[model samples]
Target: MSAAAIESPVPESVLKVEKQNKGTVDALYKGLSDGGDMGKVAKLIASDLEWWFHGPPRCQHMMRMLTGESSHTKFRFEPRCIEVVGDCVIAEGWEGAQVYWVHVWTLKDNVITQFREYFNTWLTVKDISPHGCEIRHENHNHTLWRSHPGDLFKRSLPGLILGI
Candidate 1:
């Protein structure tokens, strides 16, 4: 069976959340790219926001971009794909083969409270349930999304092998 056919349908509520999350993420990127509307960007994120990074020290591109330490021209974060899994909005992108990035934004009341950035690494989002664990069966972990390279490398063999 086809993958789409095998997968269950997404609930309407989830779709609505995904759309709203996508819009928020898009607006943040647009504000950064325009180099104006810093107020709008500020409104989207929380005052005491927490951020985490898992990559090279020099690859703190998102933090630098949001903090005005780096200009849009220096490193633009145009997300190739944006997905909402539960309360997190995941955005993944890449700049050629060298740089791959994934940004996980957690929002509450439409304001981003936490940001997790992954650079030059593959990411897989899964939903684990402790309640599903039984005597013999392992805890259920349903995969929500996976990071993928841009169209340029998608069709290549190495990209397929690496699944990035």
Candidate 2:
């Protein structure tokens, strides 16, 4: 199924949270791209930011952007898909065929507190909630977003071959 088709019905309250989170993420990206008010970007991100990276060590593009080591003109991050799952926002984008990225931003009180970056790697985000005594089960898990099949194959092939 397509990424957009994975969403299940959600309450209005949840939708409101998603909308607010979307706006925060959008503003962050816009500010980064425009090279505009970093104070605004700083406001969106928490001081004690938790960051994780997957794929090559050299592919820390987002960290570089955040640190002012690289400009958007050099490496722009324009997410083609953005979705909210629980308290997290997932943004996916690609640059040509060789570079695919997924950013997972976890927010608390509308400020991004955690970031996980995946470069040239396929990602699937699932929401798992408790059901009575069970902490996780197939029925309790809901897929929120998935990398496109075409993109997944292209990005995952090398890793699969190398058993990475």
Candidate 3:
């Protein structure tokens, strides 16, 4: 997000709301990157904000940042692309040909109401309606597709790993 996320002479069209929401998200990130008070950004987030993380619980660092519990003095987010799709802002982060993260943020009335984070893998947005939220994922396997015996050599191959 950047200050350029918003236009000064706002357009009076269907996209007006989206621009405002983008502006809000941009400001939030700006504040974080500038080491400014996050309390101001909190206003841009809904009181009942819904947050979900796909992957392991190793995402505690991000949770700390969001909750103002981190000791780091500065934060930086270099997004390769940020776009508004419907009511969500999708940010794809990459370095060279390798993508490291995908952030999906759902905003309503210029406030962030929901967020989903996918790290080190392709993002998958699953629609889980309230009525169908009871599905247990305890048996889910993160490496099933890539961990077959036939792929052992592939897994053993040397490779440079990078994480965001």
Instruction: Write candidate 1's Cα lDDT for 1-164 as tens digits.
Output: 88734545566776676678778988998887786567888889998989988888998977887787876677888888887766778888877767788889988777899998887766776655343331111224455676676654543322211111
The alpha-carbon deviation from the true structure for residue 7 of candidate 3, after best TM-score superposition, in angstroms, is 26
**Model 2 residue 36 lDDT?**
54
TM-score of each prediction: 0.75, 0.78, 0.61
Ordered from best to worst lDDT, the candidate numbers read: 2, 1, 3
In model 1, which residue pairs have backbone atoms overlapping below 3 Å?
none
Ranking by TM-score: 2, 1, 3
What TM-score number comes out for model 2?
Answer: 0.78
The alpha-carbon lDDT assigned to residue 97 of candidate 2 equals 69
Between candidates 1 and 3, the one scoring higher on TM-score is 1
Model 3 global lDDT (CA atoms, 0 to 1): 0.56
Candidate 3, superposed: residue stretches over 4 Å from native: 1-12, 72-75, 95-99, 124-164
The lDDT values for all models are: 0.72, 0.73, 0.56
Candidate 3 or 2, higher TM-score: 2
